[model samples]
Target: MAKVGRIKLGSQGLEVSAQGLGCRDLSGPGKPEPDMIALVRHAIDIGVTFLDTSDFYGHNANEVFLGKALKEDEVREKVELASKFGVSFADGGNKVDIRGDPEYVRAACEASLKRLDVDCIDVYYQHRVDTRVPIEVTIGELKKLVEEGKIKYIGLSEASPSTIRRAHAIHPITAVQVEWSLWSRDVEEEIVPTCRELGIGIVAYCPLGRGFFSSGAKVAERFSENDPRKRLPRFQPENLEQNNTIFERVSEMAKRKGCTSSQLALAWLHHQGSDVCPIPGTTKIENLNQNIGALSVKLSPQELLGLESFVAADSVKGDRSAIGLATWKESDTPQLSSWVAA
Candidate 1:
């Protein structure tokens, strides 16, 4: 197997693996701790040192699990750890709340530090833009965290171009995580350009179209009763049936390229630019290895365009997520003065 390569995440000098491990699924109930630790260790062993997690995932259980995974000597130092704040659960994990007030920012960082058992987080992100709080105010608190050595870099997820600019003006945003896949090309128009202009890295989450390219239409059939994708519009029987046509087109191209549909999908993102890194999450070791193999599936400029043609943004049916309000298009905060007045 080939080793995972490295990349400079942003102008801020934060370097990490070309491919990152999304550690969200490694936590939560019924997931064996020992196996999860082994999965993380395996990724580290193979040079995939960038790990992503969120405080909202499993309601903080993910960070605690990561702390244990990196507890051994030298393990933490070898990893470029990125965890997020801002989103919290209420009403028995049924109600989702986004928060970016200064107090919540500080408290969330302190809590994440404790759970991760780390003195400094490599990269900390405002998982969602809390429209109630001004972007400047939220970023101001994050700037203080950077100065205090609590977090080395800052990131934003699902942030609009204006929000990104405002946040960057307050502090350099090291990265912006968004849904960018073969079927999710909406970010290419404005968000991608803005990040490039501001020297921010793009962390492409769900780069495999949330496993659609990997398993095709059958993916919907495999979803468990409690699977969140069940609620997503794209995965609904009618929409999924329509979306399967797009997958079929990509799968046919992947076979000609001598790679799986998943590899081809990820390879397209890899060809996007050196500044873009895809963090596709998987619980199985085989899937982890497969994701890493994407680094080797090179695509020429023509092949890149060919793949894009197969799954154009309009070609895919349904919204990216069930909650449309959480995407970058809707991720703008109120003015700082308005927030202050309130």
Candidate 2:
């Protein structure tokens, strides 16, 4: 078993495993609940101590399941737990609603605490920016929570540079979670630099390009009707054919490096900087072990460039999401005075 190493996230005193385990899609339809619980325990047993989850996943079932998983055998005490709020589903899961009002923030945190059955969350994040509310108001309430010992640290996800600045001004943002992978490099332009400038950590979700870098194009063929990837533009048949070429080139490079494509993709993020942590989620123990192997697969500066050339950010086909889901580029919020006047 490979023992995962620990690193500091942000300038805060918080420290976690070099690579965290994203806790999503583990409690949804067609998923084995018992197996998922076992996977969480197995990950903690192996030193993958940073666990990430969201309230919107499975319509709140993910957090409830995590509560059950952590209660068994004193599992909760062994890891740094993180979860998100501010995003919810409406219209039978067809419409996405984002809320960041002070009232919503406090109520959401209390709900999450009950679901996780924990007294204090290690890190709490606003999952999506609510454009209607001022970032200051949201952070102000979060600051109150910190002082009250409800959450130890604050974080933001899919926030614009301006929104991040405003929120961080009110309270220290320990981390910013975003879609950062070989195929998703847009964050590097602004979000990454802003986080670095503020001494914040970057928690990279979908670090393997939603499993494309790991399983290649064949992974798309396995998507069931319920799978949300089927609706993503990148997975459409037309775009997928073009994107497969990038995967082929990356596959060749991975072979040359004597590592799997997934390991190579993760290793590239590991080389970005010490402040970046990639949380690649997996339901299978075998894949979990394989992802951990990425830690040992070192990459030289020249090799890193070679991998980037194979999948340059712009060369990849299609948007990160279908559209209108409150991504960072569209994450600016209303001004505090404007909201007050309204």
What TM-scores do the predictions have?
A: 0.97, 0.97
Sliding window of 10 residues with minimal summed lDDT for model 1: 333-342
Model 2 residue runs over 4 Å out of place are 91-94
lDDT per residue (tens digit) for residues 11-53 in model 1: 9999999999999999877789999899999999999999999
Instruction: Give the number of colliding residue pairs in candidate 1.
Output: 0
- 1-342 per-residue lDDT for model 2 (tens digits): 968999999988899999999989789777888999999998998999999999998889999999988997778889999999999777988987898988889999999999999999999999999899999999999999999999999999999999999999999999999999999999999999999999999999999999899877899989988788888889888899889898898889889989899998999999999999999999999999999999998898899888888777677889979865668999899898888723
Q: Estimate candidate 1's alpha-carbon lDDT, on a 0 to 1 scale.
A: 0.91
- For candidate 2, the TM-score is 0.97
> Which residue runs does candidate 1 get wrong by more than 4 Å?
91-94
- What is the lDDT for 103 in model 2? 85
lDDT of each: 0.91, 0.92
lDDT of 1 at 341: 31
Model 1 steric clash pairs: none
